[model samples]
Every structure is written in C-alpha cells, then in structure tokens.
Target: MISIVLIGTGNVARHLFDTFRLYDKINIVQVVGRNEQALAYFGQYSKTGSNFSNTEPADIYIIAVSDDAIAPVSQLIANVKGVVAHTSGSVPMEALSKHPHKGVIYPLQTFSKERKIDLKNVPLCLESDQKKDLEVLNRLAHLISDHVYGISSKQRKSLHLAAVFVNNFTNHLYQIGKELCEENNLPFEILNPLILETAQKLETLSPCEAQTGPAKRGDLSTLKKQVGQLKNDRLIKIYELFSRSIQMKFSRD
Candidate 1:
C-alpha cells in the first residue's frame, strides 16, 4: 500500500483526497494545512492538522499548496523520509530541494471544489529527481488516471503556458461572448451548442483546420461590420487583435 500525506485544503487537494480515498491500495495518512476551517473537510476521512511540524510519516508527501508557498511549506518537512512531490504545472521540482526525494505530479485539468471530475480522464504529468521516486509516482498516478505522462520541468512549463491560452484565455473569451449576448437582450445559453461543438471538433480536427468565421475567411466587410457593432473599446480591441492574429496565421500558411 502506498501511504500519502496530502498538504493543502484547496480545490486540487480536495479533489485528490476524494479520488485517492476510493482506491483500496492508497492510504491517506493525514492532511496538513494552515486553515483549521479548510482542514475540517478532510477530518472525516483521515487525520487533519494545521501544524506542519507534526506531519505524519508516509510513503509519499504530496504538497498541493499554491505555487508561491511550495518552497517554504516544503522546508517544514525537510526531516521527513519520503518522496516529496508538488502538484504544480509551472513550478520546477527544485522547489522541493529540502527533501531527499523530490518529484512532481501535476494534473492537467482545472479543479473546482464543487465540480466533480473523472480522475481516470484527467492527464497526470509526472517528474522526479530520482528514478525510484519516478517509478513510485508512476505507480500512484496509474492507479487513478489512465493518461499519465513523464514530463520534464522545461516541457511542463511550456504545457502550462499553452494551458493558459486554451483554458484561461478561452474562458475569458466566453465571458466576453456572454456579455455581448446579454447586452443585446439574448440568452447567453444560446451559445452553448456552439461552444460544445467547437470543443468536440478538437478531437478530430486541428485547431487551424477547425478555424472558421470572418477572420479565417478574410471577409473584410463582415469584419468591419462586427467591429463596428461592438461599442466597448476594450472588447473591440480584443476582437481586432484576435482577428488580426488569425489572419496572420493563415496568411503565413
């Protein structure tokens, strides 16, 4: 059995804790965090504490804290003998230098406390300083996820950057679309089918191939009309920028 000490109370920690508990081979030794109220959520399933100094010994110590707090939080468990890993896409494995065995187990999926996701579908990115620790992480990752990848720190940083573009930026665009619909007295739900189809198309078509609209077709008249329709200067600027970017991409092709 692989014992784990999860250190955080945030969305990622909660999701992981909920998923790990379901597997019989995984034993959650304890959960550590700074907030007592947040720690209470894990109290029902395992030992929960606010003090890092009293962390329990486990086969793996998974630090699911924020990126900035990773290093300092890791220092608290410097004396422990376990494979210490962090669930960060951008942060490098060196942040856990205080530990003899360091690794990374980044789940490439947005986590929400209220939203339930299938762990088996979520991509798990694994990295480690030691070969043995990598094997251990791989074993643990495979238990919950079918999509596991061994990613380097440099490669992981690049993936995180692309994720921001695909997830964060795309979501912001959705917000803009919703606002436009609301301003015109249209239901935002009207765009749901379009959004779903766009995502589903990615399975078979490359982004460039799936591309459509005035920008892709270079219909200057339609572009002008759309730009003229937007009253908000910020939204207009964003629209024009994206249109220009798309035009330039295909122009080069």
Candidate 2:
C-alpha cells in the first residue's frame, strides 16, 4: 500500500481527498492544518492534526495549500523524509528545498467547493527529483486519472499562466455576461446553452476553426453597436483587442 498524507482542507484538498479515497491502495494517513474547525471538517474520514509533529508522516506528503502558503507550510515539514510534493502551478519545487526529494502534482483545472471534479478527465501534471519518485507519482496519478503528463517546474509555470487566461479570464467574461443580462433585463439562462456549446465544440474542433461571432465575419455594424453599448472601458478594451485579433487571423494571407 502507498501511504500518503495531505495538507490543507480547502477546495483543492477536498476534491483530491474525495478522489484518492476511492482507491483502496492509496492510504490517506492524515490531513494536517492549523485551523481547528477546518481540520475537524476533514477529520471525519481520516486522522487530523493541527501541526506537523502531531500528524503521522507517510511515504508521500502533499501540501495542497495556496501558492503563498507553500513556502511556509513546507518549512514546517522540512525534516520529514520521503517525497514531498506541492499541488501548486506557479510555485517551484525548490520551495521545498528542505526536503531531499520534492516535486509537483499540479492538476490543470479550476477548483470550487460547489463543483464536483471528475478526476478521470483532469490532467495530473506531475514531476519529481528521483526516477523512482516519478514512478510513484505516475502510479498515483494513473489511479485517479488517465491524462497524466510528466511536466517540469518550468512547464507547469507556463501552463499556470495560460490557465489564468483560459479558465480565469473566461470565467470573468461569464461574469460580464451576467452583468450585461441584468442591465438589459434579459434572462441569463439563454447564455448557458451558448457557453456549453462553445466548450463542447472545443473538444472536437480547434479554437481557430470553431471561431464564430461578428468579429470573425467582419461585421462592422454589430461591432460598432457593441463597442458603443459597452459602458465598461475595460470590457470595451478586451472586445476591441479580441476583435482585432480575430480579424487579423481571418484577413491575413
């Protein structure tokens, strides 16, 4: 059995714990956190501890805390042996320099407490210092998902930035859609189908090939109307930027 311990109990931690629990070979030794209430919430299924000393260590320790907390949390577990990995995108493995063996197990997707993650579809981006450690990560990842990538610290950093653009920025656009719907007295449900269709299309078609909208067709009238109606300067800027980019893509030789 591969013994493992998880740190933190936030959205990412909860999602991972639920997924890891499904596999009998994977053992969650303990979930550690400073907050009494948060640790208590996750303590129901497994052992919980408020500090590293009280928590029973395992073959692998996963620090699933925020990017900012990675360094500090890692510092607390510096003396522990075995492979210590963090589930962060931008943070470097050197952040856990205190540990001889360190790596990343970053899942490239947005996490929310309300949203149930389908682990099989989520790509587990894993890396490590030792060859044997990588094997462990690969085996662990395969247990939860089919799409596992042997990504490095540097590649993960770039992918994280790209995720910010695609997932984070796209969600902001959805928020903009909600604000627009409220302003125009329109029901937001109408956009739901469009959103689903756009995402579904991406599974089969390249984004460039699947592109549609007034910008792609060079519809001057609609573009002008939308630009004129955008009360938010930032939204207008984004619209203009994407419009110009789309026009360039189609009109270019």
Candidate 3:
C-alpha cells in the first residue's frame, strides 16, 4: 500500500484527499496545515494537525500549498525519508532540492472546494529528480487517474501558460459576455447553447478549423457595429484587440 501525507488544506488538497480515500491501495496518513479550521474538514476522515515539525513517516509527502509557500514547506519536511512532491505546474523541481527525493504531481485542472472533479479524465503531470522516484509517482498517479504524462519542469511551465490562455482567459471572456448580456437586459442563459456547441466542436475539430464569427470572415461592418455598441472603453478595446488578432490569424490574402 502507498501511504501519503498530504500537506495543506486548500481546494487541491481537499480534492486529492477525497479522491485518495476512495482507493483501497492508497492510505492517507495525515493532512497537515497551519489553519485549525481548514484541518477540520480533513480531520473527519483521517489524522489532521497544524504542526509540521512532528509528522509520521509515509511513502510520499505531497505539498498542496500555494506556489510561494512550496519551498518553505518543503524545508520543514526535508528530513523525511519519503519522496517529497509538490502539486504546482510552474514551480521548478529544484524548489524541493533540500529533500533527497523530490518530484512533482501537478493535476492540470482548476480546483474548487465546492465543485468535485473526476480524476479519471484530468491529466496528471509527473516529474522527479530520481528515476525510481518517478516510478513511485507514476504508480501513485495511476491509482486515481488514467492520463498521466512524464512532464519536465520546463514543459510543465509552458503547459501552464497555455492553460491560462485556454481556461482563465476564456472564463474572463465569459464574464464579459455575461456583463454585455446584463447591460442589454438579455438573459445570459440565452448564450448557453452557443457556448456548449463551441466547446463540443473542439472534440472533433481543431480550434483553427472550428473558428467562426464576423472576425473570421472579415466582416468589418459587423465588427464596427459591435465596437460602436459597447459603452465601456475597456470592453471596446478588448473586442478590437481580439478582432484584430482573429483577422490576422485567418486572413485569406
């Protein structure tokens, strides 16, 4: 059995703890954090504490803390014999170099405590300083996920940048759409089907192939009307920037 001591009690930590508990081969030795209130959630199922100085020896110590706190937290457990891994995509593996065995187990998905995500489809990016430690991380990743990739720190950094464009930036666009709908007294729900279809097209078609709209077709008249209708300068600039980018990408001649 693979025993894991999960550090931190944030969204990622909670989700991982819930998923690990369902697997019989995995044992959650402890969930440690500085916040007593946050530890209560994990305390219901396993041993929980705020102190990191005293911790039981486990097969792996997973740090699910913020990117800035990763290095300092790893320092606390540097003496442990178990493999030390952080769940961060952008942070380098050398952050945990203080430990003999260091690795990364980054899950490429947005985590929310209220929203439960299925690990089966989420990609798990694994990396390690040692070859044997990589195998250990791979074994652990396969327990809850099927899509596991041996990704390096450099590769993971690029993947994270792309994710920001795809997930974070796209979500911001959705928010802008919602605001536009509200300004015109239209229900945002009216765009739900269109949004769903846009995402569905990506399953069978490449993003470039699935592209549509006035910008793609170079409909300057419609684009001008969109810009003229926007009351906010910020929204107008955003629309103009995106439209220019689309035109540049899909210019015919």
Quote each prediction's TM-score. 0.98, 0.94, 0.97
Q: Please give the lDDT score at residue 122 for candidate 3.
A: 92
Off by over 4 Å in 1: none
What is candidate 3's lDDT per residue for 141-197, written digit by digit as tens? 998999999999999999999999989998999999899899899999999999889
lDDT of each: 0.94, 0.88, 0.93
Q: Residue 39 deviation, candidate 2, in Å?
A: 1.0
lDDT of 2 by residue, 37-120 (tens): 877667675578777765576888899998999989988887787688999999998898887888889988899888999999
Least lDDT summed over 10 consecutive residues: which range in candidate 2? 38-47
Sorting all predicted structures by TM-score, with the top scorer first, yields 1, 3, 2
True lDDT of residue 192, candidate 3: 93
Q: Quote the lDDT for 113 in model 2.
A: 83
Off by over 4 Å in 3: none
Give candidate 1's error at residue 5 in angstroms.
0.4
**What global local distance difference test value does model 3 have?**
0.93
Q: Rank the candidates by lDDT, best first.
A: 1, 3, 2
Q: What is the C-alpha RMSD of each candidate to the true structure, in Å?
A: 0.9, 1.5, 1.2
For candidate 1, write residues 8-98 as lDDT tens digits.
Answer: 9999999999999999999999999999999888878556888798888898999999999999999988898889999999999999988
